[model samples]
Target: MKDQHINRRDFLNIVGITAATTTAALYGCAPKDQKSSGSKASSPVPTDQMTYRSFPSLGEDKVSLLGYGCMRWPTIPSPDGKGDLIDQDAVNELVDYAIAHGVNYFDTSPVYVQGWSEKATGIALSRHPRESYYLATKLSNFSNYTRENSLAMYRRSFSELQTDYLDYYLLHSIGGGEGMKTFNDRYVDNGMMDFLMKEREAGRIRRLGWSFHGSSDVFDEVLALHDKYHWDFVQIQMNYVDWRHATGRNVNGEYLYQELEKRNIPAIIMEPLLGGRLSNVPQHIMMRLKERRPEDSVASWAFRFAGSPELVLTALSGMTYMEHLQDNIRTYSPLVPLTDEDKEFLEETAQLMIKYPTIPCNDCKYCMPCPYAIDIPAVLLHYNKCVNEGNVPKSRTDENYREARRAFLVGYDRSVPKLRQADHCVGCDQCNEHCPQSIDIPKELQRIDQFVEQLKQETL
Candidate 1:
């Protein structure tokens, strides 16, 4: 059910894609669609190019404002070409460069990268002195939810990550599945939630928090208990477009942030780019940014908006590529904090963006390597890109329908091969179970295939 604030037409913005996967993820592993079949070495450079933030509560005061999210590691095709594996060497180089440039916090979980993100993160960061950086991992027990398994997962993160003491520990995607019911089952009923609080008291877990993923009611219920648990930090999805325009069961970032501020809990931001949609915007909208600062990237504005807030502890970006790392590092080195005027201009741009019906998929490639050979990201990306280009066909009677029809169909064919297109999906729904975004994979494929068939049957 939608939140009370969400009306009939209040499109739940980009974050709406999350509902379906959370239930599938409760078992802790979701099958994601693989994107491509190539990976290469990452080059690491030594330089201090990041800004720092103070999290006095965490005891390490000089936390780099930019935190590395290890969910999207670089991958190379396996020997069989049927699968992809994490490029550990590339992961190391990226970690080295990030630490060399002043980034200190590294966040990972058990389920990221099919359960290898922590191991890869450990191997890379372990070479450096343990004290040189802070490690954050989670008790990510979505599937096989049991206190026994939860305890085992906690111990395993330390074993795999090569650390005895975790700098920051999270409860992992709470409010997933059936919202409050799932939250109670995973934490409250299992007695693991209280166990975690005691672990923090022991100093083994330095910081205790939870990452938000479901409804606003769940967010409120958790935060309401702040007096008893005293959450050190909470992670939430915050970006320019999501501040006031959030759709679905989730509330706006502005509201979430303010609630945190009122309770004096510091914030950790994820999806600051809204799954990369903010970075790859419409051309007319891109011009608005270029007019103001030609040198800065389109993504930096979103980062600045995320960073400008006073209570934010650090903004996390899953930088899998070397260039992604470099650009983000430079942006934060001396983050030009957003001003009131800057925010006003961004809100105006956001309002204009609502006209285009683009899918919120961040191209994270989490939903890649479709079992049916469907090129999932490519198909969705082409549709979104065309929407930005103003070629989305609404009706056959329209004057631009013929041209729009051609543009979409031709681009769809070129973007994704015929055999791997949406038509190939078997409606098995195995992919949806593993998606972090909760997008109904087979359903979306069915709809896209229908659209393609319609375009073929009509005439201008």
Candidate 2:
């Protein structure tokens, strides 16, 4: 925990800010009035070395290459001794630490963390000057899309974030379910898009955009609206694995980025770690990533790739703990953009991952509180883990079939409660619409459930 800050000359040179204008220009929206008492220990990461990106549309605002995604704030036991609560004190500490270390972009939504992320994020960020950071939220009107309901959600974001003007706003998780029809119902037909455009014009929403997931047709259709609506930025799932190997109804990250790039729209990247999958990769893949930069965490490879593109405004990471935040900040302190050779290596790695057949569930828990109380993410992740560990055998004649079967069954029960296991999924397809990765939750659960049953039967 070295507290030694980077030299002033180097800081100014890296950020390209002159001494006279540095304070006003760099700290315009990024200065802290006070430091948190809890983090008095010196940090290994230098505060002044953070890499930032600014575009013509952003005006004087300079956004950090690493944006804090508020979907997975840390939690603690409730004061009332009930279930867990968002550890606000901890949230404040993490936010303060991030701000001190040069992370200024905070993205949240109404639906995240069962609807508490925004309030928590707002409270932590409100401690700093509004100019100290950029606040971004979304109109998460998933179920109720009436003009009235949509407007209420939009207004509530400002209240929750404690900001009158949003630096960035989005139509959250569009292009899923019924695709364009769903998009129309959510934004177009309901006049929400018109209302948001007006809000942007009025300066309440400084940058307007959408977080996309679903059909290529809907994606193209929405991008086409850029001429009329003028999207300020777009959030898309981009990472080494998803760049060319996206599953289900999702389009490749390359295609999505190219579309936004052609439109001159900056991309705010989500899922740079592929929902934490990249961090916890298969053993061999981990070796491949480490071979290049053994000093960097496996997750840093994905972060580098996401930030390498010129059009990427920032790569959002939903870091739940301090270590995750620190590692990501270090990666982007001065992003080492991947070269042509690095890109080729990752493309090959993506092809390797495609053979594993892991479900693309990012553990977002958008499909939680399953009607049957099934733990969708837990079930899917447990299966993926076994695949990575070589504990999933394809045939009974496979050398480790007996050991693999035992390991999978034992680990499955330990990871997911028997009652909450995949067998409980009733194919209701209710979770389909909520999944950002476009995972067919019911289908995957059913398949895993069947595999578990087969393992059980083989022993008898």
Candidate 3:
């Protein structure tokens, strides 16, 4: 809740507002070969060029540094054209390309993409030799943690994934919501953790760990369980910005990585782009990065930072488009680890990014299927996009006020359907618990709704 608002006067003083310079182009929805202005021209991505990492605990598993995150698979209009559906054919192509290029790890969860991710990922990866790639999924017993339900969910992952053995498994999105109390209810109280430990012992699950997004207290409490449970690996959100300036309840990457390194636990990275925020930075920040390394994509910087650490097993990217996949491949296909001076430069850039009043929504869609049908990620992402573009009008008297107002309203309507807009949020706070970022969903939606109202009522 760090002042998610910016007056025109304050913004004008913060950085030279420039409409001429735009942030990076959003991919996935674009054509296959589309290149973002912030990225360099496409170069050949070699099949044998990917960097690999491993530890004694992982045995002979040589994991690729570039892991494919199955959260944002490409989608096509459903046959009925009413809603979207995962394009299985497109997924197959992406998977084939990734494995050919040496990406050996695929991560998904039962809740991603409205619960279609595992099935689609399973379908795509099943076509390849099971040994060609490692499959990872989560228990994801968020709302229903009963012994029966949790067990059913765990078994269903195998059915959905079409795999007899899981290479890596996680306690899906632990340490959020009510913190350790919630964790206890989901894993400890229901005896799910013990069941998973037995599953590991039985060889059904080769490696077991948890992905964390909670307070430092919860992190410490869970990490302390290492002696008993002996976590095989841990997934954490790490990037240049979050290395030090993590918003919300997230612990800094510096601390998270250090804790894992001390225990010799390999760290799997998520949100290397901070939910795409690092790739799509503010215009001024983008300029500084481009000046430093004009050939690299804005995203490559974040990937390099995440992969630079020796403790990281792999860094995951949900590449829905071929271009994004290619760009990321070019980056890690033999990663040029950042120099100490480069790290210093990125830290300075991170400080500049923190000044902007953008919402830290990573568009994870965990808070989706809103009870009221409000498009939560759409609402928040649209607002953040406008903030980066300097199109959020704060006052009628300000210069470019008319343009900004029109842009915000028009873009809001286009980005979010009228029925799904922020004004419809009744503040039930249901989404509050699901968000891994610990966002106060109702409060943010209400604040945005009020702003929209003021804009609508303005006469001038």
Query: CA RMSD for every model?
Result: 10.5, 10.6, 10.1
For each candidate, how many residue pairs have backbone atoms clashing (under 3 Å)? 16, 3, 0
Model 3 scores a TM of 0.91
Ranking by TM-score: 3, 2, 1
Cα-lDDT of candidate 2: 0.79
Candidate 1 CA-lDDT value:
0.75
* Local distance difference test, each candidate: 0.75, 0.79, 0.84
Q: In TM-score terms, which candidate is top? A: 3
Off by over 4 Å in 1: 1-46, 363-378, 395-420, 428-438, 455-460
Off by over 4 Å in 2: 1-43, 77-83
lDDT of 3: 0.84
Residue clash pairs of candidate 3: none
| Preferred candidate (lDDT higher): 1 or 2 | 2
Q: Which digits, one per residue and each the tens of the lDDT, describe model 2 over residues 377-416?
A: 7778788778877898789989999899999999877766
The superposed Cα distance between candidate 2 and the true structure at residue 425, in angstroms, equals 2.2
Scanning candidate 2 in windows of ten residues, the lowest lDDT window is 19-28
